[model samples]
Target: MVKERNKSFIFYFFVALTFMMTSLFPSSGYAAESNILDLEAKSAILVDAKTGLILYEKDAETALPTASMTKMMSEYLVLEAINNGKISWDQETGISEYVYKISQNRSLSNVPLRSDYQYNVKELYESMAIYSANGSTIALAELIAGSETNFVKMMNEKAAELGLENYKFVNSTGLNNQDLYGNHPDGTGAEEENLMSAKDTAKLAFHLLNDYPEVLDTASIPKSVFRDGTDDRTEMPNWNWMLPTLSFAYEGVDGLKTGTTDLAGYCFTGTAEKNGVRLITVVMKTNNYQERFGNTKKLLDYGFSNYEMQEIVPEGFQVKEQETLPVVKGKDKEVEIESTNAISILMKRGEKELYQPVVTIDEKLLTTEGALTAPVEKGTKVGTLTIEYTGENTLKFLTEKGDDLIKSDVVTTSNIEKSNWFVLFMQAIGGFFADIWTNAADGIKGLF
Candidate 1:
């Protein structure tokens, strides 16, 4: 009886295990993976600037106010102005009444420079970036364009230039209406909405790093003592906590921007590089501070750990060495296409050999003077070298002919016309042989 009971229990155990496996595992027809499988944010994106690949994104098109991050463009415009020689870093800016009002409000980040005091352009940018001070941004705006209105105009024009289709800037400072006094009297959101999307923000950040990298020099400072014209000591600590904690702790955490407001939650644009792989991650509208950092860490860790930047087309790889490609109407039966720079790819571990490069060129359909005249230029639209895996997954890369390809001006050996008189003598000899053969054939037919 005990043996029968044990057998029954074993049968039940097998049935239960099978049920769990079937319920837990994904079925064949169901989706096993998606770009954004798990994320909790209004918007987010992960992009590799070097490769210009969008690894993952969600709600990238939704435009929303980006709060203090608007200062990124303000910083962009300021750098452009400085590059154009409109203003120098040492130039002093008077603390106007508008700055005084914004400073006294305390609702905005301010270092409290006296209205009569004068601070240089350098000091104001420090406060604007480190403390997210509203007053310093206004002063810099006025200094750059003679007034905040003109500066905002320049900001929009730069935005247009940057191809920010879903962005608009109302003020250089990202201070919201709730932080200001009067019915739009403080000029907060007085113009249009200071809005942006995740993709646009990433693009802006990428350009800022590539175009004006000095901003990172300022943004990366964990703590800076700003000595304005006044004696009041306002120490501006970097709002980006990761700057200190991750600068040394995390592998490649570099300088970037952060923003927050009642309406727009904590937003951050962070950049990091490891093993020659650099990427930008943007997280916007997180409910809390921990989630912002946590989500960023999760995304970044996934990027760094899961994906590796692999070179598919290594430098000095002879394009012709891969396979003997056929060429028609040419002295040499094959032409070589080589990679100029090593083509890099981001892929999962153990997948480095998953790609095999293939080259494509135009059809050998045209010829000039018994020589091929293929319309191929340096870096021109040749053919693509695509890497394919076992399945349908594939990535295409461009393979170009080496820059030193011989010109089409080379003389063809099989010329139909000869320049020398010896060419005519040979043609007459060949005609005599042809006539002798024809006469012999005609005499044989008459005899027959």
Candidate 2:
């Protein structure tokens, strides 16, 4: 007996270890087994833009200088202003004397900013986002917020509103203004620069893509000439080499920003769509420009090939699959349940056994005798069914209740006739406490 017990213990221990180790290290074969993944970057993350799901990551929360990535936020704010009708695409804004001088700085990337020649809001925005033109960005900031300093404040405020904790913005252009040669273009000294982790950067990009898809419309244009149809028209090629114009472009690769600074190294926050799936990859501080794009391609390939979105609950679809539960009193003897929302989940390539739901019906849905009571109505929310993702694909969703636990409503599919005795005697008993139970449950739910 003792020898048999020892063997059982050892076998269970190995099973537990396998689960743990496989989960920690993601394997190319199966993601459900967490095999420790590696990436060549200071920090990196791959996420589902729609669900805000982190597909894979490394030091994803470590803040670092973002360089031109700051323009993403600046661009978002400008478009937000346009979306809100505060500004129009054709509205012409004058180039500040400060912006004009900064544009002349050969050290920074810029478009030709002439004080005498005004550019439309749309042209200037494209110049700022596509070329990372500092002058165009500063002009947009000043036009939107009255000063670059105020614009930076708005940037930080927007970051906070988005629940991003790992971000700091001292300038809208993501450049070290004060440390760079001297005072800022707007004369407000810049210092300390800006920083954001891979996770926060992904979130920022997600919002940019979701809230203002027009950003992609601008980003997708591989090359556009500013002040077009005019002599001063300057052609600008998007710095994001992943675009089709660049040989390194990936299929379905489109709009997004890239960043490079002495401190930031080569960084890119890239997005692509294949078949209806879109993914966001933020690779920061890679050794070189090529590596940034190369690693992003690898991440995108892994994501697109290894996972897919599965619709678990189609809205308004009848859910009558689960076995019916017993009902005691009332008109019916059992009930089945269903979900209303079109719930979807991101799952691995071929792992179907990752989630097993443990149906938990509310006690109230059962009778006083602890049996499911009848007189149940179809489509009525009887209780909640909880599906706990387990084993290989154990993703967690932290809530006050539990992590990675999903719940859906359970309802009656059909009615069952109640016993005459139960109907007669139980009605009296139910009348005595039904209101009390209703009040108590409602109060408890209210407290929650």
Candidate 3:
């Protein structure tokens, strides 16, 4: 009997251990493993174009070589100059010796500029935008700042102004200074490449798209002829393969930039819109050209699939327990307060309940016990209602200065006037009599 009991005990112990191991380490067919969306890139980020809300990130803050992606900053400054009337689309600018020599290097992305010929701003911009032409980018830099050196200063300054935190702009074209053959911009080493974090790169792209949306018109062109009907005509094909006209066409994809170098691998800043929701994504240092777009698709797909623009709080929404504020010396005793606008945010699907509305009244405007003064007009601003997220994942935006919470103005729903003097006096008398009656009743109860 003892031997039999020992055998059963050992058998049960092994069975329990096997069960524990299986529970801790599931097989490849586990359902939970299917939910993970991983990217094959060094660093990546996804953002909502409308709200600047970061939806996903992986090592996004680490600064890395950005290669030709630096041209997005150049594109921004060029558009800014045009908007400020400092430059014009028809303005003709002659190429410098440095630009002309770079243009002749067919090995690099260029549109062979003639030393004696001047090109209009529009064509040069198209070449740079569509073909990622290094020479055209340099020419535009010189045209804007009189030299690449001054342009580099402007890039850094604009990066700061745009709230880009981790970045260093060494050159405009995103090329290694050594690629410029000793004629690179001043104050930068020959081997140094422009560096920017994936987060900052997304911020720069966000600002570029927001400030100068017209850039999309040029950036979306699939193919264009540089200097058409002229001797310098060159077929410029967009490097962004995700465009609808490209081999790896993705719906709603358009108007961004791509970068490649030995150090930077293949990087891309891509944007797309579907069903009125737009997403911006950046993938840096992918192994190959195809992999960059592949990883971008993964990020975009995951964002669109898992999240959506949800109107969590409707317009004129009132916070619970904060629906009204007492009004002193007013026609009415209290006034209703509500949100000025609807609160909409990109939220994970099925997680709307995780967000709660928080109302903060202007303390100075409030009297004792959160009462407002009389003569409050309809639509008068009272306080702000901000949405607070209560979920596991921490929310972040493209810029540090960006407000993480979605806020709307809290305002009075109706007008309230001061009570007439006669009405006030009558109320005071009524209150005095009521107090005497309450004291008398209390004494009678004590006697009983």
Candidate 4:
């Protein structure tokens, strides 16, 4: 009876323990805590520029019209051409009928390019970015790739190269057309043309700011005016309002693109840096200017107020010191390994030093059997060195660390192929006499 009572007590204890464990874990539908947005934007994303961490996102991947923000990619390609020497900043482009007709329409932004007039690439790019001029965009596109049709092909290819799978480009200028739109009267283009997502726009912005920071020279400008090189100075006003309206604008909020269309509403891709932390926020498809500015400001305020950029890995931070890794059946017995780079982790201020960093390396990658041959480069990526921490997500790439591995030539000292009969005989006789002489000396020392 006592044994039965003990077993029943154990069963009750286990039941209580199970209840505690279940209660300790969060529910399956528990959401990550985030600030709620006031204005309704179809899509939005906030990302850490340094670490590429998505801090907050709402419908970021949903495809929508990007409006004049498409020119961001256009601007990137044009800048690349200038950098590559395929075109020059001062290179002149003939004003075509396409450019002339667009200038006559007030609805379109133009620099008043006459049919006989020639405008330099610099004026065209400035006009396109500052005023969102459709004429300059088309003229610049034609000059770069010989025609806008061919330029669109390059745009698609470049988008593919940048891993923007969900994006498609129909025209350099994101002008809406009814024929292109399906039966939906919402004015948004069909899914097949002139569409992109907030995430991809952020990705493009990241690459542009990182790869070609000079593009901001045009995007951040308050206003610009240019003549069509025919004596008539046409004034083009910048549509980006953030430069004029905000007094406490973050210092690094210099060079990002803004866009708007009847169908896609208004969109802004803005970046700001405070202290050392840089953040990029994308607000898309807002109803009006106030909504765009308010939503973007809210996103930026949330980022600057909450998150920070912390250098988890300092400049000299190393996972492993230079050590020899063994090699088998090769010219070398061991190879030298060193840390490839110093990685930085962007997180909140206090959160940086709180988490434990776990270092991991692949054993197979470290091994240098037949995989690694002699004369490996100094900075070749031999193996991945990962630093991780515990958080809302499992572990992310602080940076993709790799081995600064170089091959060794330590096996040459073990050569055993040489054979000489005379030398061997002389060595044997010398060894015997030497052993006898050593024994005699030892015996004399013993007697002493």
Candidate 5:
């Protein structure tokens, strides 16, 4: 009786331990609590361009005027049309009356455009990017989408596809004309301000950089000639003061756009690369043009100083650190698994070491759990690995106290060939006995 009572107690104890383990370390892994940095701008955000991980954000969802920054989307659409073979760099677009009048407005930034001179896609794009020329921007928009109305529709569609939460474009120029709902002076395009949240703006910038990085080719030019070598030639200087050519330029800063409007105040989307790490910082509604640059510099300084991107699980990372798994029918009864893609995590400096890795096997890859069936091909994803940040404590494999930082797919390292009839028979026998033992063990435990 004492022996039976002891067995019951032992079974109950293990069951309790199993529940505790499941509760403490869930199969999905733990999500880490993030600490955000303080920012000064009315709407600002900093994100790791590659990882799409947001490092800092303040009122980033509130929509505000984006001003000439709206040109980014207009630029993206033109590039898309070029890439899809719908248009070429040499395609010409005539300047419309609306484009001409807007360009003539001394209040707005623009290049000297003539209604008689038709500009190529390349020259117009250059003028739009370098000079923030409203006429050049609308010209490109009209050329791509047949009309500014259709072009703005395409812009909003692309925004939706990119998961932008709050973005509304009333005109290609991003001008603030309270007469937006009413008829426009041209009797064609709506005269309203373009609205975008800082976070959405950052997201749009990422989409632009990731998909059409060539846009930077124009954004990075310190100085370039617009409609060069002609009677209408004009020299356009890069408005982005963060370029190294400028006295106040920050290190590694590169191509992006800037904006200033009465309603939006001042805004800038800037990118920089250092030591193989690239960061995207967006500042909206600053006091002035100079202050926008200052806010961007602060965000970039904080990002580069505090965070480091580290490759934790490299692509083809040998699973179990080179450990092999048993196979049911393969000629060799064991096979190896590896990571499918390289996995990196951006963390605060010196904080990466506190993380621990946990592999959640989709199949029972354990030797005792029975071998996986043969015919496993190389790169066959079979499981996932979760990395948990254990906070201040340095955790090796212990993760109960840690936060789940990143997850990566684990795959087969090599192919498992089919087995001969004899090997199959042997595997079948072993599986049968393993199943019997498991069933018996479960039955005994069930009594408790």
Candidate 6:
């Protein structure tokens, strides 16, 4: 009997312990997860290409080595130089000895360059953009700024102008300074590598696409021969395998840059457009070439499936209490106001109703009583109407200067002319008599 009781007690004790453990530490299936994505990368982000709205992010602000992806800034500067007329497509430039040595390394992504030969700006840029050629990148940097050191300065300055945060540019090429064969740009450490946050990477890509969309024309080329028909010609396959013609061809995917290094692992900045909605994604520090693209696919899939460009508030919308503003000493008592343009944002599915419109009138244009002065013209700029989202998972734009996102101009719908002096005098007289009658009526009621 005692043995039976002991066995029963032990079984009950074990059962109690199991229940306690289950309650204390819930399974992943029952736990509350903050991230919607299951990415296999150290850091990642998804952004709306048009609005710069960050749809999702995972440790996106932490700075990490960017590997060859640093070339995007170089590409931006090159495009800028071209557009500014500082350099033309057919402009010829000769390679420096440093660039020549880098080109012959063969181990690095490069095409053969001869010191005696002059290559046009277009061919060198194609080599850099499509193949991530370190030598060609430095050559373009030199062509624009006279030297790689001066070019590095230009890169950092442009980063600031573009609102890129948490970034450092040690070289025009993304290669580690050590790879520069003891000729690394002055004022930088020998072992230091280029660094940027995933958010900043997305921001850079954003400005690149928006500022110079023509970049896509070159970036989209999947395969081309550098110096084709020449003895030094070499095959240049785009590192971005997500191109429509590549092995990992994803629908609507094109025109991006990829990076790989010992510290950076595998990284990719990818963009895709489907149904007029373009999304840019960045994945950093993945295990291999495949993992970077795989993680990017997860981000893009989530964005394309869950979000869309939605016009939350129609154009010419009027706020309830702000429908009209009183005009002092005017022919009209009040002037109507409405939004000048439609307010649209990349919103998650079924969440459009959660956003509310907030209107702010310009205080300087109004009197102390919140009335506008007379002579308010039609289409006069009154103020601004902005949307405030009241839902979960609200992500901010990549830059703080994103006031234009989900915001619209509020202006007067009709003109208000000033009243004549005689009319104003008559209104004052009438108002005085109306006040007197009101006071008399109140006095009579009190007597009763």
Best by TM-score: 6
TM-score of each: 0.73, 0.77, 0.88, 0.71, 0.79, 0.91
Candidate 6 lDDT tens digits, 1-448: 9999999999999999988664433222201221656788999988889888887788888999999999999999999999999999999999999999999998989999999999999999999999988899999999999999999999999999999889999998888889999988889999989999999999999999999998899889999999988999899999999999798888888778999888889999999999999999999999997898888888877778777788878989998887999999999999999998898887776677887999999999999999998998999988999988776445588778665877898999888899999999999999999999999999999998
Q: Which candidate, 2 or 6, has the higher lDDT? A: 6
lDDT of 2 at 358: 48
Superposed on all Cα atoms, the candidates' RMSDs to the truth, in angstroms, are: 8.1, 10.2, 6.4, 11.9, 13.7, 6.7
Candidate number with greatest lDDT = 6
Q: Rank the candidates by lDDT, best first.
A: 6, 3, 2, 5, 1, 4
Off by over 4 Å in 3: 1-35, 428-448
lDDT: worst 10-residue window of model 5: 394-403
Residue 286, candidate 1: how far off, in angstroms?
1.2
Task: Give the TM-score (vs. native) of candidate 6.
Answer: 0.91
* Candidate number that wins on lDDT, 4 or 5: 5
- Clash pairs of candidate 4? none
lDDT by residue (1-448, candidate 1, tens digit) is 9999999999999999988664433222111122333666788877665544555677776887788888999899888878989888898979878777887766567888788787888888888888888888888887887787788788788877876778877777766654544323223454444788987888788778778978888887778787835477777877777765643235677667788887779888888778888778888899887777677776677677656777666653444554333333333444444544456567655566655655543444334322333222323323445444442333211111211121111111222222245645676688799999999999999998
Candidate 5 runs further than 4 Å off: 1-38, 178-191, 229-231, 319-322, 364-370, 391-408, 426-448
Error of 6 at 114 (Å): 1.0
Clashing pairs in 3: none
Candidate 6's displacement at residue 168, Å, is 0.8
Q: What would the TM-score be for candidate 1 when compared with the true structure?
A: 0.73
Residue 126 in model 3: lDDT: 90
**Which sections of candidate 4 miss by over 4 Å?**
1-35, 178-193, 228-231, 244-251, 315-338, 353-356, 365-382, 394-448
**Which digits, one per residue and each the tens of the lDDT, describe model 3 over residues 237-323?**
999989987987899988699999899999999999898898999999999978999999988887787677999789989988899
Q: CA shift at 287, candidate 4, in angstroms?
A: 0.8
Task: List the global CA lDDT of all models.
Answer: 0.67, 0.76, 0.88, 0.66, 0.76, 0.88
